[model samples]
Structure formats: structure tokens, C-alpha cells
Target chain A: MNITSYTARAPQLVQALEALAQRADNQDSASTLFHELSGITVLVAKKFTNDRTADGMHDAFHLTVGCISLGISQAGIADSNEAKLSFLLQHGAEYVFQMGFRHIKELSALPYAAYVSDFDNDAFIQQRNLKAIFLEICNADPVSVWTGDAVYQNELLDRKRNRKIIDCAKWLRKNNSNGLVKDSELDANAAISIAVIFAVSGDGCIVARTGQRELENLIARARETRPDVEVNWNDFLKKIPPEFQPILRERMEELRGTIVKKIFSKTKIKTVLTELQDHYAGSEQDIDYS
Target chain B: MSENINLPAIRQQVTELVLAGSPEHAEDAINETAEKFGDLAVVEVLNTLEPHVASLHLSAFDGGKMSLATLLIPPKAWAESLAYFAATWDEDWIEDEPEVLAESLFAHIHGVVFGTDDEERRAELLNEALATDWGTTAFAVLFSTAAEEIIEIANDIHNLGAHRSGRTTSDHDVIPLVLEIARTNEEAWDRVLFEIFPDWKPGENELHTRSEDDGDDHEDEEEREHEYAIGRTTKELLLRLRKQVPSKSSGPAKTGGRPSLGEDIFS
Candidate 1:
């Protein structure tokens, strides 16, 4: 829902950087320029920030790094270090506003240190995040796990699996928000139609196939959004299992529209669930699409 | 200055913070140690913390990877006057505790590869990891992302991965780079096979080498099945990789001109 505009305030920072580059011959000026550049980055970042005027400083700093990171990526096609540096020198400023604006939205996203305020370690934050996911799977209170801080060793919740669980949890959270879960509950003999499926099969024994295909679709599917890069589509398609071919092609087609210029963000996990609704449209499969 | 500061108390405090899963606080205490008592005191504290840091239980459900890595770094690092893991975190600087260091390094590498859009930096970070003493572990962890629930190894080479894992997703450029490293680095490829299949002795029959835990005495049926189900397809995939980049022990005296694993899976 947030919109971005950078047409007015980015010129001065651009001029300052251009001036610094002109004086690139001076060794003593590097430190002074470093200070000046950082100050400008923060200043320019604050100018672009919308809400969170208080944490503007933190958001500004991360926004700057994210800005530079995005620029370096946009310019990655350059063959040499000198070329990339030159590319950054000439065009990086133009990108600063756009990329910075894009990244500021993700300031509250995972892996950024700015938002993981209470936890001192990034590792702890990921654990807490995944635990949020585990709680989601059980439909338990998200804050309940930390109630006693009682530590239990769970080897199944490793990083690889945790990512899937987290993605599925995000979908479940959205479903909860959209009243989909409540809507499903209004009918008799109807189960919720989330990608997450756990059935008793009425026996203590196992009665289902592995969730790998659905899990891969639900979890790791979002990470597949690298369409900006020059990927060989056919070769990429060949690597996946045959069952997933249609879903991937459909996802790729969606990526084309959702991906912004050089930056990819619509890559977040949501599309496949919507897309797979058709793939499973009216078969004898007990899967719900309610 | 040194005599006034109690080094043991500082060590106990820092180590406890780390083991108890508060590496951020441990890092703060480490900074305070460096500030009040200076670099020599920092070294002494890390020396005390080394083996204990190695013993840090890391996983998603246990102590976090970066948190554990943040603590383990100052102790395991071969650096001089360490300000801590910054750019040099994955820059191949482990003098010892390579196994322990690799756990954290891989976490950082995954963060970069999956987090950022910079292809060049991603390759550089991963390459730095592969060049380290834990290169083989790097290769294995990348190939099969040494599950976040990294368990304590048993009768193994004190290493990573316990559960069965796979997925040849070429969604990003990182996997291609990892395969490229495995294809080219012969020594690592050999150890990579061993790293994935802890029981397989390179040239030996992989299934024969595997110790199947039938779980006859196991009370928890799920854990029993999990134990039995570990690495079934991983062993199969290792064989496929072996066919491409044959290990020195596996390739009929490891033909000198053996081809690298082709770009079929990668490109």
C-alpha cells in the first residue's frame, strides 16, 4: 500500500558524489569523502523515508547498504571491477532513490538487524521466527513458546525445513487475516483449504504421500524469482521434476508481470497457492479449495 | 590494568551467554573485555572459550547458527586483534576448529547467496568459504544445506547433516557456483561424498557401509522411522555426483583426466 517518490530530493547527494569522484586522485580526501558520503547517505535516506520518523536513522543506514547492494547487482553485467565501479560512479546515484525506496519497504522483513530489536543475535531472531512458524503449524499462540523459555531439542526444524514451514505459516497467517479460515468453518463437513494439509487418515499408521511437491511449491517457490537475471528457461525447467513443470511455467509467467525493473520482490510466497487452485480444480483428490 | 580485571569471571560470563544462546550479549562482553582489559585479555578469554565454543549446540530449534557463529568466531578465528566477524567472517581464516567455524560460515554464505541480488559478491563469499579448511564441508553444506537442525555427529569425522535432504533447484546462481566448485576441486569432491554419506568410505559399497538403525528398541516410532529414513536418497544422489566427478578412491584409480560434473544440472 506504500507508494514512493524521489524526484525532488536526490540531486544534492548525486552532485556531492560526482564531486568526490572528480577528486578521486587525492588520498587524504578519501576519509573526508567517506564521512561526507555517509552523512549524505543518511541525509538523503531520511528525506526519502515516509513513516517511522523516529527509527529514520536505523532505516536510513540499512537503506543505504541495501541501496549500494542493489546498485552493485544492477551493474553486475559489467565484465570488470573497474567497469562496475565506473558504472556505479555514473549511474548508481540514479538508482539510489529507486532502490532505496524499494528496500525501505523490506526494512521490517526478516534478516534485517534493524527490526530484530530485542534479540542481540541474528541467529536467535531466525530461531524465534521459525518458532513463530512452528506455533503457526500447531495453530498455537505465537508468543506462547517463549512463555517459560523451556528449551526442547527439535532436530526436524532445521534451516531447510524451517524455511518451508515459515512460508506455509505466512500463507496461514494471511488466510487467518482474510477470514478464509472462518469462511471455511461455516459449512458442514468442510476442511480449510490452505496448502498446509494434515489428516489423521483415521489410523495411527501413515496414509499419505510426502508433502515434498506441495512443500516445494509452498515454501521454496518464492525464492525462484530471479527472472531479472539471464537464466536459460528450458534448462532451468529440465532440472525440476515433471510434476512441477506446469506450476513453474505458470510461476515464471507471473514473475514476468510482478517483478519490478531490475529488482524482484513479488517473489514472496503466495502465487502458487492461487495458481495451483486450477491445477487441482475439481478432481477426486480430497484437497480443499474453499 | 590486567591484574585489576578478573579474566576467569569474564570468560565464565561470556561463555555462559554464548552456550545459553545469548551470543549478542557475549559479543558485547567480548567488546567490553577488549576495551577495559585490551587485546591480550581478549586472547586469553578466547583461549579458554575455544573447545567450549566448538561444543556449542547449533540448530534452528537449539542455539541459532549466527548467534553460535558470532560467539565461536572470536575463539576459533586465526586473526590478530579481532574486532569480530565482519567482512572476514567467511574469508577463510580458521587456523583450527574448521568444522565448528564452517557451521557459522555456511550460515553467512547462505545469507549472502539467498539474501542479496549481487551475483559477484555471492560468488566471492561462497568461494571464500570453499577455500577455507572447511572447504569440503562447505561443498556438502551447499549441495545439501546441512539442515538447520545440525546435530552433534556420532562416530563421524565430527561433522554436519543428520536428516535426509535433496533438491537440485537452479533458481539462483549460487547452486551453480557450488556445483562448479565441487566439479573443479577434486580433493573437496572426495571429502564431499564422505561428508554427505558419513558411512560411505569413497570406494566402498555405500549401502554396505551404512549402519541401518532398524529401531527395534526405539520407543518413539517417529524418531525410529526418522533414523531409518535418513540419507536414503542422499546416498543415491551422491552416487550420481560420483558418476560425474569421480572421487580419487571411486574412479578406477581416479583417472587423471576425469571430467568435472557437467553443467547439465547447473546451467
Candidate 2:
């Protein structure tokens, strides 16, 4: 359907939802409202899916609406009572993690490594780092919004914890003789290092210094035992082992690319790219013969 | 002095009456003929002689009720009769009432139309519809019918807005209309089902049952087997798609165009 058709139908569906919210008298009425809203949501989802060019923001907007409706349904069930509202609040938290967060993570198509990747690398990296950035921003308490205040603090701590573990795993893999560490041992080591780092730096520190120090000391200990062994974090970071790097890089790139495609594919990227080309049309750098 | 009007001419007149956008004229013609013949024999003769016209009337009546029981006439009969009508009659003879036609057809079909009654039949019909062009046609018809129901729902929603904030309408004013509409429109009912109980699976038989079992003894085993079978099928499909990916082109030269990235990003 054309945009006009969508615009025309959307109001009708929205109106139905509003009606439902107003007249919600019992569980069934609330349930009916939920069902009607869901149908509209599904229709919107299908349209977005079929559009082939719908961007991440568009998809997110649709998801947000669905999420809000779900919240409203819960509220309706609670009958606007404080006791029920408290129950709903707890339920909403669980729903956010179980359904909302999980779905966003899955739909994000973020590379496993990129989730831990430093945010300053490239434009794509910046975009891919939204979840982490959002967590950090939310934690900063820049806005006094209740949801943000509640979420940011927890997410910020969780992300830091998560990042330390990832870094520790990478460090162990780099220093290990066979480039393989026992999963349990890796987890224990990472946990210890993360705890030490958090204790030393407090919650406000952006970088985890103690974790890096512990990781370096561990590598030094491994190198001392095997004198001929080489352990270099820089080398490990800069170049993956020839045998594994290409495959791992390709996989990581694929995942990262999928996320970027999902997000920007339907946005203003086309027009932006076209404008860039036009601006550089006759420049010496525009045509790279080499 | 009745020189006996030519039978074909009479039939043609009847066809025109049926197609003239006048339900009254068509009803009158049928009633007049029945009166003239005064017997079931005449009725049978009329049906045989003007089968297309008769089917049209039948279709109209079925559409009006949105009743599947009347519409699903046997597949062989449906195909033969519809095909004959299409071949013999002009395109203009078919009415543009998509909502009516779809409701009638869907209601009549044992399985696909009314899924609650004969579930096994409904599944078979769903499978058949998905497997054939008729399925697509049926979907289009259903979608059109759904569109009208959706509008009515929108209206109800608007009325609810007016009722809120100390402007109360008697609850009874809203009950019958919404309930009746929901009852008649399968789409609305399905929406209600999905909303109230999001996790309910409609066609669990295919996903749960096995071909070999006929007894309750193997029921649990059958369910597990089918679950495994579905999981395996899903894995195979994913693996097959992965395997089909070709080696990536090295650069723009291989692509024979600038690496646009726009088209590559989405699909």
C-alpha cells in the first residue's frame, strides 16, 4: 500500500486503540484492546518488513509503540490501582529484559565482538555501539526521566562488567601457549580481575585499570614459565593469527554489516551518499585509478 | 396468441435481469418461473438450463450471510461451475462485491474458512490454499472483507472516546454491535484471540502429531518426534541458505558498477 493508504488506515487503528483504553471495564475489555492493538502492530510490522527500505529508527519507532501498548495493557489490568501498578512495574521490568531487550539484541544484528569493541573506531562502529552508548548515557543521569534513571545506572555497571570479562578472555587467549583456555578458568580469572578493577576505580571510572594490570601480570607470568614464548597484547589486538583471523574477521564483519544494513538501509543513507559523490565529483581523490 | 417466446431469448432476458444490478428483478424472475412450472421438475429444468445464473444467485445469497456452509459447494462442482461461468459469461457479469464473495467462499470451505468447527478439514484447506493460486485469490478476498470490519472497529473506538470523561453511554448501547460484528468477522475474532491469549497455537496438530500413530499410547512420543522433525527442518533450511552464499566479489570492477552499498544493505 502507498503512504496515503497507510496514513488513512493508521488513524482508524489508533482510534480503535484509544476507544479501547477509555472503555476498558474488565479483564476481557482490556484483553480485547490488547488484541486490537496487536493486530495493528502486526500489520505495521508486516508493512515495515515488506518495505525493504525501512530504517532502524522506523523499526524502533514501531517497536516502541508495541512496547508502550503492552505497558498500557498491563496498566489496564491493574485498574489504575497503586498495588496493581507496583506489580505491573515489576512485571514490566521482567518483560523489558525477557522480551524487549532480547528482541532488540537479536534484531540489532550486532557482531558479538563489536558489542565489546571500542566505540571510537569508525562511523559504523559508532552506530554499532548504540546499545553500549545508550547504557552509558542513561547511566549519566543527564535526564531526570524515571525510566532512564532506573535503567542507566544498572546497565552502565552491567556493561562495564561485561566488557572486563570480554577483555580478560581476549587477553588469556593471546597469552595461552595453545591459544585455548578452559572456559571455567577463563570465567574465574575474568571475574577476579573485574572485581579488583571495580574496587580500585569505583563506579565513575570509564577505563578499568586494575583489570588491564592483572591481565598484563598474568601474561608476564605465562611468558616467564616458557622463556621462548612471546606474549604481546598489541600484536594480538592488531593482527589475528593468520589461520584464524580471516575467518573470524569475515564472520565479525558479516554480523556487523548485517546490523548496519538493518539500521541504515532504509534511512537517508542513499541521499547522503549521493550528495557526497556529487560534492566530490571532479576532485582528484574522487577517481582512484590505482 | 402466445407464439411461445424463444427459450434462448428468454434465458438471455433472465441473465440480463440477474446482471442488471437489480436483485429485485432477479428474484422476481426466479419466483415467476417457479410459479409457472408449479413443480420441482421445472425447478430442476431451470437449474440445468441456466446453471450460471443459478450459481450467481447462490453466490449472492451466500455472500449476504457470510456463511461458509452454503458457499463451499464441492470442489469439483465449484471448479466446473465457476469455470463454465467464466468461459460462457462476459467479465462484466461478475459483481465487484469482493467482501461478499470472499465471506461466502471462506464460510463454505470446510477447513480454511471457519477454522473452529472442522479443524482437520481447515488445516487441509489452509494447506491447499497455500499450495495453489486459489489460495492467493482467497487471501485477497479475505483481506478486502477484513478492511470493512476494521473500519467498523475504528468507528466503535471513536464512540468509546466520546463516552469517556463523564459522558457515559449505557454499556448496553455498545455491547450488541461490537459482539455481533466480532462474531461475524473471523478476522476480528482472531484478533481477539491473539490479544487475550498471545501464546495460543491454532493448528497444533501438524506441529504435534505424527503420521504413523493412531493411538494415545504413542501420543507423547509422537509430539516429541514432530518437534524434533520441525527443528531439523528449520536447521536444514538455514544451512541450505548459508551454503548457497557465493564468494564475495573482490571490488567494484567485479561488480561492474560503483559499490553503491544502498541496494546491498537491505536485501
Candidate 3:
């Protein structure tokens, strides 16, 4: 359809989606709804490419995806049919725009056309890509959207926050001796135990902060984006022999202990230890300080 | 604009400029976007617009020279313009009589009929459009058909990434041929549009968009099924329109004049 039909059809599409969303209370209806929605969304992930480098492909796609996603969220609150139609067109444009992000290698058949040019898109894809980035950062090290300092500062703000969180935050703040902490906090590494606060804080968007789920997601996302990559997080771990389990565990313990230990009093350490007990989901035994 | 910029707000501001008798400013921004990026780039840029932007652009005072934005005005804007024209269509706007215009439209109808590969179905469409209220409305429906035909040609070309699959002069792809006829019919349309027609055969992966693995496994079976179904629906419509074998029972598609502002072709 041309712009004319598309514009006219958009409001009805949105209305249909809204109606389907309401009917989505049932599984069959939900499945049908998902199927229909997928039909429209897959249009966004269509094949196209521009003159950008291969390295720029991933970033550009995400940037466009983020922008498109944000455009959907900040869509005009439609009091009239016209406003509503624009909302649908924005959603369609997001997909059409996304076609510009195909990799050059896959795009050898495509003729070079100048695609959308914009500065970097640091959009708040808080639910998907950004959250994944945040989790992976904290998982690799301890840095997070909420670090130990952030958690501590968070505690100081609340009247009825976690008592254990308060104790841990105070213990963490005691180590602010050598560096200037801007905003009285930083996105530094949070303790594995402390980072768990956001992980299991009932936020479904963050699938996991660290561990098997996080590793699975990392590998899954990696493979989803680039299918040719040979990396497999599960395969690598599974290949490790059962006999070396205890030895690896001992080494792992050593690796886990070099945190703020000097002034990390028994109470603070105990709080971390308690949280750590459930951290591994009973795959390994509870780690002990004794 | 910044990465985290408010697209709606920027569009709102632009829309305000266009509406409050300052369309030149928005036109200037559109021109800048087109020059800096590309013509197709305007599609992404216009995706941010509020409603009624098209109606404002298509107005007599402003004119539809919306730079590259004219190439692909978001459908919402088009819908608004479609409505605007419907509401404001004045019979007195055209001095030519219906019979005289009908006679004039006959050759143009053949040109458009040749545009679509399936000439028989398009001929049937012309016949049906010709049967509309004394050729004035027939003229409207015929132009709509030509517009639709042109759009189909453009979309097919674009989906192929404008490659044309190494088919040079006299390649005789329906796309380029259709574009030629459409460029004649739509003389005032975007010039860039006429330049991007491509030629590729059916079942041939000329664009190489489909990887070998895609044929092997699709992650979401249901989604794949739905997508197939959606595409099948389009093909089904085409097949119905262009009946391969002329049967006694199932004849030419019985679709009548379809320029009823909000009438869904799919429906």
C-alpha cells in the first residue's frame, strides 16, 4: 500500500491491536493476537542495508530500534482519529527505518542508498537492550545502574528500606577514602550479593543479574544477532569435567573474596553470605567463611 | 537531533510551523534532511510527525513540494490528506465534462493496465472503474488504480533494495516498465521514485535477503506461519485479481470503484 492507504489503515490497525489486546485474556486469543502483531512487527526487521561498516551495523540497528521503540512509547495521546493514525504510522516507520541496519556482508546484493543519518541514539530501551547491557556489565564486574554506593544512597533516601541493605550500605560507604564520589554515589561494582537487590526485585524486564540465566541470555542474544558465531556459554561450562568441580569451586571462592574485606565487619559480611546462599539456586553448596 | 531526542515534540514543532503558515521552515528542514542523508531518509524523519501534517502539506497554499518527504509521507499523513480531499472535492474544480474526460482517460487507463503484469485483471478494473457514475468518479477510481499500480511498482523495486539484479537497458522487468508508464501518469510525483525500479525474477534470491538457514529453521514457528499467511493473503488477493485460468464460475475480480476515502481494500 502507498502512504495514502497506509495512513488510513493505521488507525484501524491500532484499534484492531487494542481489541486483540483486550481479547488476549484467553490463551487462544492471545496466540492469535501475537501472530497478528508479529505479522506487522516482522515488517520492521525486513532486509535492507546502507553504506555503513560492518562494525557500525549492530550499533546502528540498536540505535534505530531504540529510537523507534521510544517513538512508540512517547506516541501522541490520541484524542482524535488523526492523532491515532500518526501513532500507527510512527510504529510502521520504525520498522521501515530498521531495514537500514542490515550488515554489509549480507547486503552484497543491495545497491548502496543513503539511509537515515542521525547522531547516536542513546534511547532508554530500559526493558531490553539497555537492561541487558546493564546486567552484563554488573555480571562481568560489579558495575551496575545500581552499584554498592547507589544501593547505599538509595537506602539513605528511604524511611522503611531493608535494614540489612542499610547495614551493607554503611559498610560500603566506610571505604570512600581515596576517590571523589560524584553525586555522593557512582555506578561502581556492587557486591554480587548487593546486585541481587535489583535482580530479584520482582522486575521481570531484568531476567537475571548474574548466573546461568544471564549467561544463557548473553549467548542467546549473541547468537540471535550473529548466527555464525561459534561461542556457546553453556557448551563451554558443560565441557568442564565433574572431577574438577571441587578444585574449580575452591579457586572460585578465592576469586569471590577480594572485596571490601578489611573493614567489612562480620555483620555486613554475614548479610552478603546470607544473600549468597540463594544466589546459586542450590546448584552448588552454600559458601562458608569458616 | 540527539539520540535521546523527543521525536514527537520535534514533529509537533514542525507540524506547528507547517500549520501556522510557516511550512517553508518545515520544508527547509525536510530539504536539509534529504540533502544530508538521502531521499528515503525522509521516511524515517517523517515517522515522527503528528497527524494532519499531510493535509497541511497537500493544501493549495503550501503545495505538496515537501522535498524528499513527498517520496514517502507517513501513511497517517496520507490518510489525513485522503480525507481532506474527500471532504473538499468540488465538482466545479474541474471544467472538463465527464464524457470528454472519460474519452481522454481511455489511453491513460491502457497505460496503467500495461503497468501491472497481469493485464487482464487490470483491464477488468478499468472496465469496472469506467462503469462508475458517468466517468467523473470513474476518472477518480482510475487515477487511484494508477496510483496503486505505481505504488506496487515502487514497493517491489524498493524491497529488492533497488538492485534491478544486473538487468540493464531493455531488461523488460515489469517494474521499470511500470515506472515509465507511472512517471507519465504521475508527472508531478517524486522524480527519485522513477529512478529506483529494479528487475528480479520469482523464486530467485537476487537480493540474497533469505539466508540458507532461514529455509532450515525459523525460531518462532507460529510467527513464521503467520507471516507466511499474511504474505499468502496478499498473493491470494493478487491471484484473485489476476485469475490465471479464465473459468466460467470464477471470472474477473468483482471489485468496483474503491476510492471511498476510508474503504479498506483488504476488507
Candidate 4:
């Protein structure tokens, strides 16, 4: 079939998948639906490659659909077509744009004659707009888009800052050094977790402070993005051989403790550690800070 | 029918006949054996003989380019040989037998026909085979003929990693030829397309309605719109196929009026 035919056929393939997904009520059926949808996408990709007009840019659209659909299903997202569509559109759009922009470097080699002249610049314009929209929608502190060296350097700095913030937050949670901390008070780890949650959820930027209602929204968003996020420790331990489980758990605990101590030492919260040490050493009377 | 026929020795004689470039002798040996036993036993033995022959030679085309005349048998011999197998293929037996017998017969036909060594000439022979009439009791023998090869390629890709095959040319080069055969008449195209996409129907385009309960997000709405556009695009392709331009009626190039988009990287 020609590109025109493939272009016509892709939608019905997607619709058929949608119908199948809508009808699926169990895991096996949902898996089958996802498998068929993936197959259709793969076939479309194969046809796109066969198409003479495909410059790897047109391929990005189908590749995105294939990757995102596969990712959502593999990520154990809900089988409902609505949920799958929501995740795919939210995540896959940026991926498509990112892949498109990434290809521009390779595309620079092609002669002007290679361009699909009849397509004009509409596809190119749409791709450019998608990248811009991806950035706007993500509102990520350290944008992952491939820009020139200067922006990359700044992104590195931003990432370093985030790492430092996360370390401090993790320390605060472990030390519980704030004295009778309330559930309402989020430490550095919770704040960074919320930020990562928003970054993944495609919900623009993380707000400065998460109120009760805002935290609830973030939780809901996290649930949508990572439905299988929870790891059952008991079931996990049962799977691990009995002899290895205790050692593994002990090593994990030790690792956590060591990281907390290191973070506490580096952070401003080190003063709380100093106070506790001083009281233990009989150098000063206990002073309640909270 | 006698157990004293010593089928293994007979099969070896046939194998040597095919290897020695006496496919006619090999076929005669098979026929004489089939008369004693049945077509199934002869076919089973012939099935083993094909692999021996295949190992002795290469495929007809190299990197999608047709080589000069390489066929051992004449064009008439190829026609006669294919007709023999087509006539012997039992209608009721198809369901019970492994498709291997049919596959082996077609492979033998292709092996001999492609030997003519000219791509265009080989294509013509293929066209003839596709048009050949099997007896009324038999299934459309050539219905899934070309598609079966395409399915083989698909299966290979599925089993082995695509890159591991170390193929020099894309399957598209051969696909056009198969499609040409498949599209000889509307029935042929219909059968091939049905095998490829079973759920496809003429009315499916009209049956699809706009999805209700659009999610409360802008992204969902945009994706839905894109999907609608894709459906419309596929509808055009389906309509074009429905119109059915004759496939093999023309030249060997099978260009089908699609402009040369650019240099194929595979080339």
C-alpha cells in the first residue's frame, strides 16, 4: 500500500484497538487487546518504513504511538481505553516531539530535494510546536530537551541543586529531628517526591507548597501514572529465599541509615544532630525546640 | 499397495534425480510410487527431497536483482511440473495434512520457475501459475500462495531477531511481486487481504462513530481528533483497494504509478 493508504488505515487500526480495549473486562483479555494494538502499530511502522515519503520524521509519529502504547501497557496501567489513551497522549506526545527534534541533526544531511515538497512546512511546524508545548507542559526545572551546550550546562546545575534538595529532605525524614513532626509537615524527600510525581504526571510544574487538596491531586496523578508503584514487602520477602531475606533486609536498612547520616551531616539540619550529640555527651541540658 | 516397495530407497533415487538436474525423472519416480501407495506417502518423501535440492542451489534473485537465465528446466517443464502437484493436492486432505506438502510443492515450482533467471520472465511464469485452474473439488490452490511466503518472512522476523537475518534487500522488493499475483483478479486480492487482515470489512469505515464521553482533558480531545484523521486516511486506502486496479496485467516493474520517492536505502 502507498503512504496515502497507510495514512488512511492507521486511524481505523487505532479505533479497532480502542473498541477491543473497551470490551476487555479481564487481565487476559486486556493483555490480548494491548498485544493486538501493539501489532497494528508495528505493522503501521513497517508500512511507514516502506513508504517513499518517510524521512524518519513521519516515522516518529508512529514510533511514538508504538513506544507509548507498549510503555503504558508494560507499566501496568489500567486496561480501560480511556486510561490508556490519557496516558499515551500525555506521555507519548512529548516523546514524539523529542524524537522528532532529535532527528533534525540527522535530517541536516539530506539534500533539499529529499524534502516532501507537497507537505509544505506543516508537518515541520507541527513538530516544532509540539516541542515547545512539551517544554511548557513539563515545566521541568532541568529540561531534558536537547539544546546547545549552554542550556545543557544550566540543566546540569539545576539537576545538582535538585539532588542536594532531595538529600536534605531524605535526612529530615530519617532523623525526625524536628521533634514530634506532624503528617502535615513534608520534609525534603516528600517535596522532591511530589516534584518527581508532577514531572512524570505531565501536570506542568510542581507547586511551591502542597496543601491537603493539592497533595490529594498529586496522589491521584501518581496513581494514574504509576498504578503498580507499590511493592508488597511481605510477598517480596516470601519470594526471596529465607536465608537471604534477613541479610537482604539488614543490608537495606544499613544502606538507608548510612545515607541518612551522610545527608544529615551535609545539610543545615546538622545542628539538630549536634544538639542530640551534645545532650548524649552530658555537655548541655535538653532544650525542646518544638 | 505393498510394504515391499522399499519407499526409502525410492525416495533416495528421486532425491538423486532432482540433484542431478533430472526433475522430470524425479517427478516420474514420485508418480510411480504414488500409484503404488498414495499421493500422501509420495508427497512425504518428496517433501524430504526438496530440502536436499534447496541446499544444492541459491535463491533465484540476488539482492532483488534478477540474474541471467539459470533455470535447469525449460518453461514447459515448469508448467507441467506445477500442474502435476496442483492436480494431486487433495481437497479434504488440506485440513488434515501439515501445510508442508503444499509449501514444498510451491517451493519446487518457484525453484524451477525462478531458474529461468530473468526476473520479468520469472514474474510471467508466476502470473501463469496464479491463473491456473485447479479442479472443482480443490480449494483455490493459489489463493494464499504468495501470501504464504509473506507469512513465512513475517514468521522469520518474529522468531529470529530481524537484524540477525543479515538480509541485503528489504522484503518489499518481493512483496510487490506477490501482491501483483494476489491482485490478479478481485477474488485473489480479496482472499489475500482477508488472510492479512481478517476483521477488515467494507462497512467498517461507516460503522465507526465519534467516541462519546470525551475525557475532561484537552490532550484526550486532541488525540481523538488525530485518530479520526487516521481513520479517514485508511478509508481512502480501503476505497482504492475496493476499486481494484488490475495488478499483473502490466510490466515487470510493478511501479503502479507510485512516483519514485527517492533512493531506497536498501538499494
lDDT of 3 at A276: 41
Candidate 3 C-alpha error for residue B164, in Å = 18
Q: Clashing residue pairs, candidate 4? A: A8-B233, A8-B234, A9-B234, A11-B231, A169-A188, A169-A189, B71-B115
Q: What DockQ, on C-alphas, does every prediction get?
A: 0.01, 0.01, 0.02, 0.01
Question: What is the alpha-carbon lDDT for the whole of candidate 1?
Answer: 0.37
Query: Which residue pairs in model 2 clash with each other?
Result: A35-B195, B68-B107, B68-B108, B72-B108, B111-B121, B111-B122
The residue-level lDDT of candidate 2 at A165 comes to 43
For candidate 4, the TM-score is 0.20
Please provide, for model 3 over B123-235, each residue's C-alpha lDDT reduced to its tens digit, 9 standing for 90 to 100.
Answer: 34334333322222323322322333444444565455334422334332233434443333333222222121122333331211122355556566434443321121122
Worst 10 residues of 3 chain B by lDDT: B258-267
CA lDDT of B116 in candidate 1?
40
Model 1 misplaced regions, further than 4 Å: A1-290, B1-6, B19-24, B37-44, B50-142, B145-186, B197-267
- In Å, residue B196's CA in model 3 sits off its true spot by 30
Query: Candidate 2: lDDT of A233?
Result: 22
Question: How well does candidate 1 reproduce the true complex, by DockQ?
Answer: 0.01
Q: Using TM-score, give the best candidate's number.
A: 1
